[model samples]
Target chain A: MTRYTQPTTFYTKEHEWVTVHNDLATVGITHYAENQLGDIVFVELPDVGAEFATGDDMAVVESVKAASDVYAPIAGKVVEVNAVLADKPETVNESPREKGWFCVLEIKDGAEIASLMDEEAYKAFCEGL
Target chain B: MSDPTTENLKRTPLYDVHVEHGAKLVPFAGYEMPVQYPMGVKDEHLWTREQAGLFDVSHMGPCFLSLEDGIGGGDEAHAKIAALVETLVPSDIAGLKEGQARLTVLLNEDGGILDDLIITRPIGEAAQGSLYIVVNGAVKDADWALFERSFQGKAVLTRADDRILFALQGPKAVDVMSDFFPGCEELKFMHHMPFELSGTSCIVSRCGYTGEDGFEVLVKPEAGLPLVKEMLTDERVKPIGLGARDSLRLEAGLCLYGHDMDPTRDPVEADLAWVIQKVRRERADFPGAERILKARAEGPAEKRVGIRPLERAPAREGTMIEVDGQPVGIVTSGGFGPSVDHPVAMGYVRSDLAEPGTKIDLMVRGKARPAEVVSLPFVPHNYKR
Candidate 1:
């Protein structure tokens, strides 16, 4: 399994996680988000060449309970998606932060990443919920 | 995140037990019910199918309809009470054997379903003049009002809404129940009998919504928690919630009262004609009999059918269904089937498009997803006779 243990990861209010490395950023849902979804069965990913704005619905994660939209954490162009999720959607429930990353985006504006919540703030936000 | 809509939500008898088990509570049918436990919906669903899962259905209406004094006794009282109830529904209530249950639908004047319920004739001489009825939780108040207006002065309706109703469903359900209450194994499908569990008077019915061999126990409010705790002591049993219950019923092709069929949809159109027995059809004496019988003979315009989306994406309720670019119908209930390991749906469609293998399109997020009409009970039933 692909492992992602980056310390610079940022989180959105919508429960998406972003880990920026150089000019590209990897995006996925947080563990708390996947726990709320409950056993994802399908993942609809955007095309690799598609462009998205921050907060736009970039993908859909459907579970046995309900379907939820995964929003983009930063404005960028999609570079790659986790193709393995097509046959194995449970990866999100198993590992929402690592191998379950939805897609990687070529960063359009670096300053947008700085506006997201840090790990401490994200933990506090989840606790409040 | 505090919403005022949840302020008036009610709690079931097992509310504290659910919270202690780390359940995720959600508002359903005007009650704050647990949607799933820490095991999640899929895992809970699979556990019920493989072993046994206990569900707290206390929110549903469980009541008894008893005849007044001098209403006759023994078989005469049963016949009179059945005749009175037959006026509201299209089931063969009079023909039901003592200790037998039948699945029936309450009808409106226009022949649409008010609610689907399980009505049983109790055993023994003491409860002979009464019928035990269980209705959906969401419409219990409306159902009670209808009964009051329809059968006023004829029968006394006693509401046991505070009593807890738990359904233990799975292949191993009978085994577990037999272990708990000896002789429960003798109860056949659709049969119910009064029994005592740990010195508590309870009723155990050999029936459930899931297509599995199971039993539904109706117990006093105070005995609910202890009964659940005792059942969970067995390795085969676990506490299931509403999320898995929904998916399990969907997989079994059971129609949800409000979502699958309601006051606007009749039983014939819902493909539940078998519920209306042949003798009742000939008599044509119940409410909406004219419209229901006409639809039965000539067939309805649209019919409910099972759907399997070719893609992995789940098509949810209210999704539009089309055929050859023409709108046909809308999905009533759709979701992922944990047992089938695929997505399954049920909806009404033009009679011409209701046949199995007929291709259709499900409009999902502005795209038409390929799907096909298929036979129901996405997963086969395993009822023990």
Candidate 2:
């Protein structure tokens, strides 16, 4: 059984994954990204009501070694932020694709999903690294 | 000669072991050392705090120093060697007992810190009256030069660059090591003893940087990899790298030589006054001892303190720390502490703002974040005897 993603979800070159069921797409970091990041120490999420264009920097993930920005997969309005991450950032390392989900967005352009890499291509890209 | 920058980067004796364990290798101090392993920095940091972790510190220089002679070389050699070393550091080397170790700073004549080093007097009555020293990797060349020019032919300095040094640290370190070296469990902190491992004679020092019960083993470079593999075969031992080493030390409130300290920082300003012994401070011997003493009495203008950011953002090294509207100091070492589960940083600020609970601001990429000075280590340091 699949744990973190549905067959309909997609991933990005930066290793963020988004699961879309309708107008809303739930976003989180990929397992590969979390592993490379070492331990998730602190996570900065965008404001709940903030609007973003496709590929805009919306969040930040920091590890002991370095910090990286997590970009939005598609243009949308941030509906909810992951409040649990403030106290327990390691959740991203424990379950990067599930409980570690960063934010939910109201997808402004549903067609943007086609712009992202599919599951097969994403897995191959991660393996190449 | 080929361009020095393009020359091959050296590898420590245990470089292959790090690769076999899937460690991320990075260039450090002119050697390719492991930065982290497959378990990653966070797990390695916590596991080392909870259990035992093995570190390949062979890149650091371990050397022996003493007086030399051909015919008349008994008590006279010991006296000369002791006097020569006493000039370089402020430690009471003449009074140090056999097998005892002292942490001392190598100071410049201008009262700036050169580096911090560990000096062991020696062991056994039959051994020669030489001292063993382990110094930082980056400044080993400078340390060698200082000893050479100061002692000249009067004292002999033998470099042990071909040796391997491994640190086994954590609460269970002694238990794990005792399984191999039966007598190691009895060694106290800052103490060392000569022991045999796999039929090879080695020196195991009951000292470490992680604020945990641990031992640093010095062995022949050729035999280092096999020992590391053997130690790691046990479930309790894991391979740690530079990444975790830095984070663990930060969490323990230990100073990293170049990042947290430099020639510009004195022992007093860095809050390492305990290392400046009273003998040196009173007698005012050794380089820069006078300035250090004066700083201690009158107080250092700046002080190092811990900063905890109010937001989930991190204030990294080189970031500006400000008070009210003026810049005070810069963050020296900053990172996410795995044990504390938060971003923690250390830096120097004006003495008046060094008190805990004093509000401050950290400029992270031109954006100001709320911060405050708090007690160091962010997490409690648990050093077992």
Candidate 3:
């Protein structure tokens, strides 16, 4: 039941969402992405302290239908992951933008977040697909 | 996503209904079929297991094979028709009771399975000596050609490919279907009969790809929408798409013709030896009987077995399986079983590695994930007697 209300949230063409709070950016897939993947059964998350470049494959989200790669929208080091998803993967479908956040990353370059699409831009991008 | 060349795809009789119900259509078996609906594949799959799910199987090939001369006068004419069909596939067709149906495999001369089909002998006295057969949509043309060539000048083939075939499956299917067809509840699994529905003569078979007790109704194309809409009026009945159909059948341990087994694999290797009856084995007269019987006696080099991956990651089709670091087989069908709530797969492995409890590794994205060779039917079947 979690809602997407945060205004600082950004999105990638791969359907990942990034919400910047101070220097840390929280990452998770968008609802549009979860709908396409169907019922998620497994999620492979990166470990804390792991470094990733912008657009690098950082996690794998597997659903009943297919497996998809979640890429990092900004270069950063993983700081935290939603360990709850290990046991309740359906959260990605139920609350993808909020409690279903995959991980929190310590941002290395704040400017990379600006390059991503905002909510309005992301909506249009999804429509194009 | 829409396909640019969707005009080239064939649409089923219920295509507009699917579109109206918010189905996500995709190209499958040359048809623009609905893969899933707004409820999603997982929900559709689980719903069918608990209630009743209706599927548009109109894309499949449903036809009748009748002897040139009218049948039912005596056993001689019936036996002649059965013998003609036996020439193409290995099954005890002559032993099939009037209303009984049998699942058989179409074999090539080299002992490979061309396709798997359901053949049922009509029950009505008027339709005697006629066999109602349903083959895979992808290979229906080839099957028709085989039938024409094999039964040249002996029998007349009637194509009902334009007919609407709907499969109403799951636990509550009997209750919902019995209300409509009245005597359908009396038909046991693998039995079929001709019934009149709303002034339309239709054939209802108490069988389905899903392990659940169900009935497949074949009606005229014009009656397809009305029949489906009427069935949906029942609270337990929901329109299911191919996505749930695949998962449900996979959990039931039913093989998908192209994905699980194709013309390259034989029945014995596919673990379908039961389809080859004792009488057929003794006669050794069907196509590829020499190699099929030999494999049945000595065992096939590789056999299909169910697999349970120790990890949550599904080992999809084409994933290589290894035993103690040595490659032995490849997965033919693998996916997350919604009913079992785990990842299940079926693959062909060396006969030695096909035993239950044998430990193996599935190469998923180049990593060796632990798995075990287990028995088929990730979920137990619930067929009504």
True contacts kept of each: 0.90, 0.86, 0.66
What is the fraction of true interface contacts found in candidate 1?
Answer: 0.90
lDDT of 2 by residue, B328-348 (tens): 998998987778877789999
Winner on TM-score (1 vs 2): 1
lDDT of 1 at B178: 90
Query: lDDT of each prediction vs. the true structure?
Result: 0.91, 0.85, 0.89
lDDT of 1 by residue, A1-129 (tens): 222345368899999999987778899999999988889999999999999998889999999989999988999999999998999999998999998999999988888877889899999999998
Best by TM-score: 1
Lowest summed lDDT over 10 consecutive residues: which window, candidate 3 chain B? Answer: B70-79
Q: Which 10 consecutive residues of model 3 chain A have the lowest summed lDDT?
A: A1-10
- Rank list by DockQ: 1, 3, 2
Clashes of each: 0, 0, 0
Q: In model 1, where do residues sit more than 4 Å from their true spots? A: A1-7, B1-3, B70-72
* All candidates in order of lDDT, best leading: 1, 3, 2
Q: On a 0 to 100 scale, what is the lDDT of residue B268 in model 1?
A: 97
Candidate 2, residue B58: CA error in Å? 1.1
Model 1, position A23: C-alpha lDDT score: 79
Instruction: Decide which is better by TM-score, 1 or 3.
Output: 1
